[model samples]
Target: MSNTGAVMQKTLLGWIISGAIADKVVSTSCNLSIDQGLDLKLSKFWDIEEVTSSQNNYTAEEKACEKHFIENYRRNEDGRFIVKLPLKENRQLSLGNSRDLAVKRFYALERKLCQQPTLKTQYTEFINEYVELGHMQRIHETKLHNADTNKSFYFPHHAVIKERGNCANSPP
Candidate 1:
């Protein structure tokens, strides 16, 4: 069935109408249990499943993420959300070494910012405000390694100040 048996183009009365037979998304039926079995399967593209159950479909790790978010997230003094990143297990971070990539991207961003002084100012102010709001913290470059793993990791970040949905090249 997965490899694509005969595809059903449409249903005529109670019988399925057969069409092409290849690896594709199409409604099909077969009698697996019995020779006259009547079970129809309609592909929702990319073999994606529909959420039909009343209960949540969270995996253990996903449930753990939700639990972490629920337990740790809080409101700031101004009643704004001070949300923590939902991670799995005992607050463990498995970020790999990304200092090189981060530094490269940082230089690229710096170059772009230098070209636009007003944007640079706005971005700087935004980052400063983020730090002031306790949403972010300034860390020394010398102490950038994770204590447990002893690997340098960097969190990737970008800003999206939207007048409309464009990108970094445009003046957002």
Candidate 2:
């Protein structure tokens, strides 16, 4: 497999594990069946730690999402956020599609985050960084295409640190 494929697989796995952890559905015996040949078990506490670490290995936009989640939300004892369902025309629906419910929950969280004054600057900075990273990635991909190279480029960790430094030096 190419490096890009490996990176994408790792990213998808990280999202799966993070979502499971957040939903408090992570179990002591975790089984993953990707294909007929790939059956894996994640056991013990260390396995959870490994998955958490992988989730932290993210792009600028992803890091922003993680920051937003951590700062604006609190998990219950079960490690899941208590999200109330939206009322539909003064009546509560007993059943709803999971995907639609998830989208509503996400939008609710985003609205809560937007209400915070202290987080406003942070969120703006996050958006700026995310846009910058997107532009940089597109440029890099174009360069690679012109050079006829199949290599994929990820943002350097040092660039993140450098951006932090610039933010610190600048006035808000």
Candidate 3:
């Protein structure tokens, strides 16, 4: 699932570069400055290129990330890959609980849904199907008071609706 892509990206970089040889051919890459947002947009850097090819340089943090990945990644019989969350040797996530933000965002979504019935319907159906398929499960009330609150991962989600193409109004 794309949900695991972040972890996969960090892990796979180690594997991809392990046996790589420096290219003898002269080549260049674009040194792009992109906004810190995730979206399904093409890399718009190709049009602008830098004369150098040393863009493969990895930062010290990235090197540590790759090393952590190499040592912790594994695959099971179900073909799902797993790895321990990569934290610096003596570091932990210095963050607060996200439940408040999640609640706020959910209410915002609910407001949006109230204004767009069709979208709301589509989103409801999609979420119902997802739950039915067991991709997600409702957290039991008893476990909501988990002692290790910081270890909980909160994922944000939304439905993408198509308004054009032969796909019609249906979600692709």
Candidate 4:
């Protein structure tokens, strides 16, 4: 296979291992299959250090997802964070994959991460960074009304806005 082909194969393996394996974790029906393929698949999915420490803890779905993402996604070598952004110029770093797919994968990871309260912190932190970058802002105000039964609700639901930078002027 060509280099791109090899990378693509790795990427597909990573997604299958990480996403699907995570889905089936802790089920008894597949224990034997896991026993037969888990170790080898783990080797394919993680680096040596990660494999050493994490081998015993991962569910098959988690393993599959890990392998999938690692192969397709550009991650820090020390494994601190997965680069969630789409392919960028001047970075010389990419998963050698498509942007739309990365966004889809990110949505998946976001859903999974949000399930853990601690992981939600990462989102908040990223938002803060985005705010600093001026890429994110508060832009609107909602008018609240108490309808017939006397329940109050904001009109237009939750909306985005540009931050006014005035503490008193900020939305409640």
Candidate 5:
């Protein structure tokens, strides 16, 4: 199962880049910094390093990021969790807003992922795309509606995707 773990890690890495982790992270840190004067600058640059550097080191901030990242990616809808990526600075684009940056990053990533030829790559890319809004759950719902025709993927409710079956039932 080592290979599976490796693949999972790689997939998670892609999701991280797809603004899943970073969006939550940057937003969370900014808020914390603002609320507690926690030196968000240092937190921004240091927190990732701290978590990545040592498996043993676990600060409250670091733990918060880890928890927040997972929850936000699942589209938990925490008000504080949603950091609107900024787009304007002094009337013009600030180039610092996360939402704007995420949009740009996602577009670039989409282009790159589209070029790949493998199912794994395609699935990863698809998941990455949905990460921002928890599309995984929706896909599961769609799968259920068309289960007879499409039997390849099992739509797990726990998946980040939303389930739409409750909206209306289909006839056999």
Candidate 6:
């Protein structure tokens, strides 16, 4: 398995254990506060110090980047950076913008998860497991599809690429 898969598995296991402990603690300690219960449960199975240190390192790196960008980048009257580029560069810029939007959405979701630390364990477990399962399902489907000779998949868009006699690189 890749490093990401291993990390997800470990995180899922941790959350499962933590959830079980939390359930037991809540059942037995009727008067205990949610925070106290969570603390007790996490202390038993989770390495709080390690997680905190990792989070601190991430935060520090982010702050450093923000500081650097603020000091180095200049904005125009529209409160944005102005750059001059040739018409040929527009396509590349559009593609880059799409990638940036995806990254922004991912970070926004992470920020939401951080804001809800109490539910972080369960949420992380669910999201990671769900995503991994989906990936596995897609791989399985692709393998099955590849085994079938009746269907075909195309690349470079259907309108752009065409099968012309013995030549495979011809445009439609």
lDDT of 6 by residue, 1-172 (tens): 1222211123422322222232223453223324566667777766645555444556755776655666667779889874442223234322222333544665776776688775566666665786888842333655744543333222111111223665566554
Query: Candidate 5 — which residues are off by over 4 angstroms?
Result: 1-96, 119-172
TM-score of each: 0.41, 0.20, 0.41, 0.21, 0.18, 0.21
Better of 1 and 4 by TM-score: 1
Winner by lDDT between candidate 4 and candidate 1: 1
lDDT of 4 by residue, 1-172 (tens): 2222211123422322212233333753312223436668787667654635767799976776676777777658798666443443355332333434544665776776668766567667777887999985753333212222233212221112344655887775
RMSD of model 1 against the true structure: 15.0
Cα RMSD of all models vs. native, in order, equals 15.0, 30.4, 22.3, 27.3, 29.0, 29.8
Give the per-residue lDDT of model 3 (tens digit) for 118-138: 999999998899899999998
CA lDDT scores, all candidates in order: 0.66, 0.48, 0.66, 0.50, 0.46, 0.47
Model 5 lDDT tens row, 95-165: 33243444466566566556754633655766688786775454455654554432243322212323356
lDDT of 2 by residue, 88-150 (tens): 345543332343444466576567567865555666576688888885323454564464222
Q: TM-score for model 5? A: 0.18
Runs of candidate 2 with Cα error greater than 4 angstroms are: 1-102, 135-172
Candidate no. 1 TM-score: 0.41
Candidate 6 residue spans exceeding 4 A from truth: 1-97, 131-172
Which 10-residue window in model 6 sums to the lowest lDDT?
A: 152-161
Best candidate, lDDT: 3
Residue 36 accuracy (lDDT) in model 2: 29
> Worst 10-residue stretch by lDDT in candidate 1?
32-41
